[model samples]
Target: MEISEIQHLAALARIRLTDEEAGAFAAECDSILAYVAQVKEISTGGSAAPSAGAHKNVLREDVETTEPEAYAEALLAAAPDRDGRYLRVKKILGETP
Candidate 1:
C-alpha cells in the first residue's frame, strides 16, 4: 500500500501517529511489499510455496458435554445488565443493511 493509504488505514483504525511514525510504517510496508512482489515474480515450477514448518490437518475427538454454568456466569459478570440467559446490549443504528 502507498504511504497515504497506510495513513488512511491508521486513521480508520482510530490510531493517532505522528507524521514521522506514519512515514516509518509506510517505508516498512513498502519494503515488505517489494519483497513480496519480487518473490511473486519468480516461477514456483508449479510447486506450492515453501512452508516455514510443515503442518498437516490435526484431528481430535469431540470433547463436548455441557459447558458449566460457571462459564456463562463469568462472562455475564462483565455484563452491564443481563436477563437470565442473555446479556442486554445497547442498540446502535445505521450500520446494518
Candidate 2:
C-alpha cells in the first residue's frame, strides 16, 4: 500500500494520523497483503477433501426428551399472581382494568 492510500483510508475511518504514522501503516499493510496472497495461493492449490480419521459431525443428534408443556404446572405453582391457569402481570401500557 502507498502512503497516499493509507492516508485516504485513515480519512475514511475519521482517524487522524501523522505523516510518520501513515508511512509506517503503508509498510505494515504491504507485508500483511503479501501474507494473504500466499495463503490464497496455497489454499487454491490443494484438494478439497478432509483427511481420514477426522470426525465428520462433532455434535450429537438433536432429540426432545420431554413433552413441551411438562414444566407448565411447576411454573404456574411458582408464579406470584395467577388468574386460573394464566399468569397475571401488571398492565404497563394503555388503559387498565
Top of the candidates by lDDT:
2
lDDT (Cα, tens digit) per residue for candidate 2, span 1-97: 8888999999999999998999999999999898878856665545676566755757766887789879888999999999879999998798857
Off by over 4 Å in 2: 42-97
Candidate 1 lDDT over residue span 9-63, tens digit each: 8999999887788889988888888888887787779967677588888987888
Clashing pairs in 1: none
Q: Lowest-scoring 10 consecutive residues by lDDT in candidate 1?
A: 64-73
Residue 59 lDDT (model 1) = 82
lDDT value, residue 40 of candidate 2: 62
Give residue 20's error in model 1 in angstroms: 4.1
